[model samples]
Target: MSSYAAVLRTPHACRAFAVGLLGRLSYGVVPLALVLAVKEGSGSYAVAGSVMALFGVSGVLLSPVRAGLVDRYGPRRALVPMAGGYAALLVVIAGVCLRGGASGVELCVLAGAAGTCTPPLGPTMRALWSELLPDRRMLETAYSLDGVCEELLFVGGPLLVGALVQYAHPATAIALGAALVLAGTVGMTGSPAVRGMGGGEQAERDGARGAWGAPWRPALVAAGVGVGLGGVDLLVIAFADGQGRPSVVPWLLAALSVGSTVGGLVNGAVRWGGSARGRLAPLAAGLAGALALAGFVPDPYLMAVALALAGLFVAPALTTAYLYADELATPGTRTRAGAWVNTAVNAGSSGSSAAVGLVLGQLPLALCFVLAGVPALGSALAVRASRGARAGVPRPESVTRVDPREPRSTAGR
Candidate 1:
């Protein structure tokens, strides 16, 4: 009996890990694939960048709807169909660009469609982890591990795409990307741990029927932070392009990722006794400091170091936003709540990218960096204000236990 149980557990862990890896890879590869297709088909960087912006727009528009679907059905049911649809869309787009030569408008439409079909993989996966490991400690560890997985994907996916495009055919890279998405989606859906479990349908129905309330203040603040970071990213890219060293853009971004990964790991390993509200101050302060440094730095290497320091606050702020969403969300709307947070981030990034692209040629890149930091400072101020207002309010104890197969309890208010 012990041996059988061990075997069963091993497969479950492996499947979960594989799903995590695939989810990150799919996300990281899509942008690279789009860049390649646009350069090859249209020979225009601006058009390619526009197509990428369209993808972000579609993600922002579709995330809430997709999240609601996950809440309505289960993540497993929603993910399988969406993933399959996304794979089909990718193949179509690849074929069109390769054979028929997709125009800018056509590419934008297809990219938007592809983005709309993307599954709410991150939130769904988080929900799965919550269900599988009910303990708070384990859940934090799982999220930390997911953060590491994200870094790995960003590191490896572009490298893989670059190699395939350089050595093999670009088509080969697209096909491989589609295959991985399909395989991972199927693997995830078929897993007993994900498929056999679900948050009760009745709770979701009830939650959906309720009136939509005003946006949570903390969530808005977090979205503002995302906007700042997005602007910073655009500035970095612009600076690199202006310097005739576009390749360094990835390294700068990677520095941020590396810093955030370390922060997540450290936060997960340690214990914090204060209320969620209490941590807001330090998180905001850290973000402000990072932003200040990034704005002030002169040299490229120094700028990378400043951006990395800023990144230390990024994951912590994101995790806190998730926690706040969990607190504010209605009983069955957790997935949508999380998705709203994601949508905000994407929307902010999309908006900033568009704004930056127009003035990038006119303005000094250093000024762009300074302007980007303004939003972060603004977000920190907003967070501080919100925390002050809610200082006396009692917070519900954090609930990590999630038995998706079982009905939700109505006892908590």
Candidate 2:
């Protein structure tokens, strides 16, 4: 607990983290709100789902580009306009939905446009954390804390929407989400830490190209993790429905969240002796193994237990990936590098969910679980192979290995 306190105690750390969380909460709120609003306006689930798909696809695919802008222009300049445009689009979307006259095409166009302009708050806040905490251990704690809070916000956002929808139209929630983001972004960018940060366009372009290739390990692992976890929700519901216990689905999902939360906190508190890269593959493997065994559980209760066990590896794997991404990133490319991993995870999740839905009807349930585990296992193998590929190569005499634990200067970054 004190370790986490040490992280918050850093000057300006609390404010930046708080405002970032506030802005990011909209990410949780908007998706469900948009779906409901579009469904209400269009009178069709099909149209709503299609609109969301377009929105998510645009956001996930363009994340790195937006992050590059943040890197090239600095956060203060890049994020403010992005948030403003995004908020304005959300307002337009809410107005269209509430007025009840807009066509499906118009709603889809607005949602996609809003998604394209969606602020890269998560990636940006992570970059800010790196800048604020130069010490590697504390940074690890910060990432864990951030991950857990994010997971909770996602859980809470839906409940908040659930409450709001009882008394007000879903479009109202969309408008509220827009307001939260605009307010949070304005407050966040005004902070001294963000103000002090510089644009890295020139430095990023001048740096060696070789530095760009190294972050693939973390990004790949993150994608694999995303793929493994993405289908769990549907799979768990399927398992429960098969047993005629549909009511248990929510409890099972909550178990996964609880396990992940506990695992993330524990991961940060421990002082592990290895590079984040070295630990990442094993963490992924643990998740893959646990998920593979999930299908063998005999009942919904057992399935919940199995998933909770699997969940233990979830946050730690991702936290390690983010930490590794930071380690691999140059100061100028920090946001872009993290954004790649962010994009990979989201893309993997979206892809896997659709793919899993297609195959679930055709395959045996156990086989489906095994199939879902393959991506993470493949990622673990790729990491090992990459390491072996480099093992035989001789190190340059000019370069010396830096101790992973050493607290170095953050002069340029």
Candidate 3:
């Protein structure tokens, strides 16, 4: 905890971390909020799903480009316009939805635009850590803390959305989410800490490589990890539904998040013996064990405990994945690496969510845990097959010396 404290004791890192969190919460909440609004208005999950799907697809299409822009330009130049513009669009869409007579086609178009304009904040913030802290050990802790904050968002975002939807309105929730994201974006972009992080000559040269470089293979492996983690979330949801204890779901999920947060901090503090690449498989496999045990838990309480244990390895594994990515990525393309991580992980989550949704009605609910574990283990194999087993870079004193004033490089093509 002292190590974690030392990493965040500075004011700039605090601002970035704090505002980054607000933006992340908004991002996590919006999909479900949109679905709830659409479903309540349209009276059909299929149409609601379609609208959200369109939104997601549009975001996916633009993520790489936006990430590239941040790498080329600075975060302020790339993110401010995008975040502000996106918030305004969300406001317009919220008003339209609140007014109650918008056509599905119009809503879909708005959703698509919303997705396309969604600022690539996830990548930008993740990249900021590299430039801000620079020290390898401190960098590990920063990533760990960031990952834990994301877990917190997953836990809290839905609850906030649920409350908003239940009490005021989905439009209120949407507006609030937009406001939070925009505020966070503004705060982060305005911070000089994040703005001057573009690098010098070596970074530019490294960032000049094509997008299809070696970093992507490991990014895909990270995606598989996302699928597994996402599957766990979906399976837990299914398990709650199966047991007719829907409210218990939050407690179970909270336990999972808490465990991950604790484990991630511990992982960060320790000076682990091996390279991140070497540790990746074992950590993932350990998650697989806990997830597999979740398959047979008889009741929700036991399952909650199972989930907590399962979560223990998640952050460490993901931190290692990110560390591996940082090592493999070109100098100027850290933001793009972050973008790849975001895209890959979300892709996995989306896939697993859809898969678990389809199978919940057909198979025994317990088996969903097993099904989810398969991907966690598979991610390990993916890592190996992708030659992600290459050793991690040695920690160097030079890592502490990155200058934030250099112009960052780009590799869009």
Candidate 4:
């Protein structure tokens, strides 16, 4: 708790964090809202799902490129136009949905455009945190807080949209989503702290190899985690629906969220003994084991307990990945580096949904759960093997010394 308090006490930290979360909330709200809106307009669940798939694919594939723009030009210049275009497209989507009789093709085009232009707020805010808190330990705490809050936002955003749709049209939720992102982006980018970052400051620090080199390890781990998580999501739905206890699904998911939130906060507060890089394999293993165990649970209530165990590893793993990415990043490449990990997780999750669905019908559910755990288990072995292969090579220092102009601390790393 003191660590979180220290993080909030940093100058301009609260404002930047607050506004970044605000903008990111749009991500949670828009997906559900847009799905409902498209379904209402097209009168076809198939059309809604296809449009969302296109939107998600476009957003996930192009994330690194957008992050690069922010790195080259700075957040202010890159994010402003991106947010404006995204919000405008969302509004257009809302209008088309509300007008009635809109074609599926038009909605797909608008949704794809909006996704392409979605500002990389999550990455940028994380980069800003690195700049604001040079102390590696403090930075870990900050990332934990960020990850936990993001989890909550996704959970809460749907409830908010659900309430809004009960009274207002589904299109209105999309419009509100547009407004949230626009407002959040404007306020966040205007901060002095964010304005001080990027602008090609250290763009060439790593030469032609680019910022993609060292952080690939963490990105791979993140993707594995994503794969496991995606499988869990689809499997949970199947589990609940198969048992004819649909009402239990939300409780199961909520339990996962609660475990993640507690685990993240604890991970940050404690001063762990080893380097974060060294801890990655064990964390992956923990998640893998928990997931494998989840399949054997006889009922939804017991499965929720197993899921809570798995969720305990979720935030800690991601927070470590982000922290490692930040460590490997140079001044100009921070956002891009983080974005790679960000993209990998999303890509893996998105792809896993389709892959898992095919296996679900043919295989026993227990075996399916074991298969879902394979990715994280593979990640654990990969990280360990890589560490063994590079035993003689010196690892990067855990502590980062910030410029005197920014916040600096000589506390424990």
- Give a tens-digit lDDT track for model 4, residues 231-253: 88779988898889989888998
Q: TM-score for each prediction? A: 0.83, 0.92, 0.89, 0.93
Sort the candidates on TM-score, descending order. 4, 2, 3, 1
After superposing candidate 1 on the true structure, give the runs of residues whose Cα lies further than 4 Å from its correct spot: 1-14, 43-47, 103-105, 196-199, 209-215, 237-250, 357-367, 387-413
Cα lDDT of model 1 by residue, 12-53, tens digit: 654865765686587777778777877677778887888887
**Model 4 regions more than 4 Å off:** 204-214, 387-413
lDDT of 2 at 251: 95
Candidate 1 lowest-lDDT run of ten: 1-10
Each candidate: RMSD to true structure?
Answer: 4.7, 4.5, 3.4, 3.2
Residue 410 of candidate 4: its Cα lDDT?
19
Q: Select the stronger candidate by lDDT from 1 and 4.
A: 4
Runs off by more than 4 Å, candidate 3? 40-44, 199-207, 212-214, 237-247, 361-367, 385-394, 397-413
**How many residue pairs collide in each prediction?**
1, 0, 2, 0
Q: Single out the weakest 10-residue window by summed lDDT for candidate 4.
A: 388-397
lDDT of 2 by residue, 310-368 (tens): 88999999999988888777776678778888898898888889899999979999988
**Across residues 18-126, which tens digit of lDDT does each residue of candidate 3 receive?**
8878887888788888887777666677778788999998897568777877777778777888888788888887887788766787788888999998888777877
